[model samples]
Target chain A: MVDTQWPVYEVFHQQARGEPHIHVGAVHAPDAEMALVMAKEQYCRRQACVNLWVAPATAILATEYQDGDMFEHATDKSYRESWGYKTPKTIKTSDEETSK
Target chain B: MATMETLQDLDAPLKSAVIDLLYRLADDAIIIGHRGSEWTGFAPILEEDIAFSSMAQDDMGHAHAFYQMLHELGEPDPDTNVFGRKLDQWKCASLVSLSSERDWAMSLVRKYFYDVAESLRLDSLAKGTLIPLAQLARKLSSEKKYHLMHGHMWMPRLGKGTSESHQLMQHAVDTLYPHALGMFESTDADSLLDQAGVCPQENDLQQRWVAEVDKILSEATLKVSVQSSPVYGGRVGEHPDDLATLLENMQLVYNLDPSAKW
Candidate 1:
């Protein structure tokens, strides 16, 4: 059978203001405008969403999972993490002890 | 004047008018929702299938809310009112009863036409004197905004798309336009509702509906000939045979076992 469907669009939804638009799913639409409308009806119908965006799946670029070496670190990178900033207490004041 | 808040607040005529109006609204939602749902797994694309299903659910939900309000006014429950009522008692327009015929262009045009009228009607009801109906319309209108947007997006796209698409869209519009106009068929209660400050006159609503539809169609380059006649009788329960068939399908399961909990 001939493929009569439209192109795929990746949907991003923002739950509320100051929130990032996380990728929810994809929908097929003939154009960007229709894609956005379909995205709302498909993904945002039951959920609370303040904003939505859709980009053609063909427009997106990504690295293959097989190329994990680009994302992997060869050496220890724990110093770059926030958890590394925590240090054992050298001393404790009476005020700190009371607060704790 | 204070708004009518409940069925008991109205006199005999106003109560009757409100019931008539509620039936018109509820039947329109239920029937149109049913027709839209026939496209559930059959739409040209999966996304459209999902979109139509969502809107169908919204339409049915709105219909149920209206039915619930009627139940408070001493009518039977939603299922009974929807399934047990005789065909002659249904108040849905012929516009909603017509089958989509599995034509994508016809389906989109029908939705665009219906959504424009429904959006305008809901906006007017949102400010009307029936407080409960007004509150419900207010809530429902927000959800209908997306439905209107869906219509707005597609009507023009297919209208201006390829030669074949354009031809199909124009043909669908020409075929469905008269039935679409029938959505404004007046009930005997229309005047009573207007006099009681409960709702706008159907004629006035139709006028606004015409202007809005024309504006959108014009932008799509689709010409609407000035219709010489507006199809009527739906508001008073006269409908094409299509409604009978649609009701059979809609009430099939419920009628099979009215007492069984599902």
Candidate 2:
């Protein structure tokens, strides 16, 4: 095995037209263009892809999983989610419903 | 230039010329792909192993495409063309026939030279008069663009790297230069292919390749010899003993049952 490892580049791929680029995997490359090319050969060769992007792994700012408190909320915020809403049975009247 | 669209549309002489060119292209890809795959699981790092392995598959795929084109021209299937033939029957360049051994620097340098020549050849073929071959070359060239990137990225690193790496790279370059030059050895079909605009002359491609490789080597501060003799003859079926060993190992399984579905 090679003793020295090159820098890691995180690869992202857009599956088809009008699709968001999703993180697929990573590959080692000496530079950006090489990274993009390697990412294509490694990740997109077997599947269809419209576009690809690569960034140095070290360049990404990541939140650690151990920091659970950063995502915790003291108060209920269910209103922000669709599951919080209940079914409304009926409308009283066209005038009343349109009023408020 | 004649618009030789398909095998059926070609005259006898032109068809033979085209098949000769296809054999050269296909054999080079297959042999080099085998050499590259030899580095699998043995590269200094895991990622490099994966990278080389992936590119090997690309090389084989390109080879398969060329072989399929040959099949369309009335040659045997891809498997027989690859495994059924004797060692001297191959049309690969001597550069691709030599082993890379366990030296990563040598592999990189050899591939760098091979990749440059292949890129230039494919570029010419992409504009070829043969429609089916032209379309195939255009598609395969897109894939080869990345391979060139792989070579360009690594050659500089190895050339300008630390003392040991730089020494290794320079040595490999000096040693492999002749074999690399052999890649442009002119075949009897060259004039026919050139006249028909089916492909560029080897000399022309060689000139462009020299300019491109010279620029890259200059950027890397590596010195290329001006007076080394090229090791030719692979195009006409002559090859080094290394090719025999390579074939023995490559065809070990396929030779057992050439007709087996695997």
Residue A88 lDDT (model 2): 52
Clashes of each: 0, 4
Look at candidate 2 and give me any clashing residue pairs: A1-B44, A2-B43, A2-B44, A2-B45
State which candidate has the highest lDDT. Answer: 2
- DockQ of candidate 1 is 0.60
Q: What tens-digit string does per-residue lDDT give for candidate 2 at B154-234?
A: 787778878888899989989899899999999999999999888989989999988999998987778888876889999
| lDDT measured at residue A89 in model 1 versus the true structure, 0 to 100 | 65
| List of clashing residue pairs for candidate 1 | none
The Cα RMSD across the true interface for model 2 is: 2.6
Which residue segments of model 2 deviate by more than 4 Å?
A2-9, A27-38, A64-66, A82-100, B259-262
Quality class of the docking in candidate 2, CAPRI style:
medium
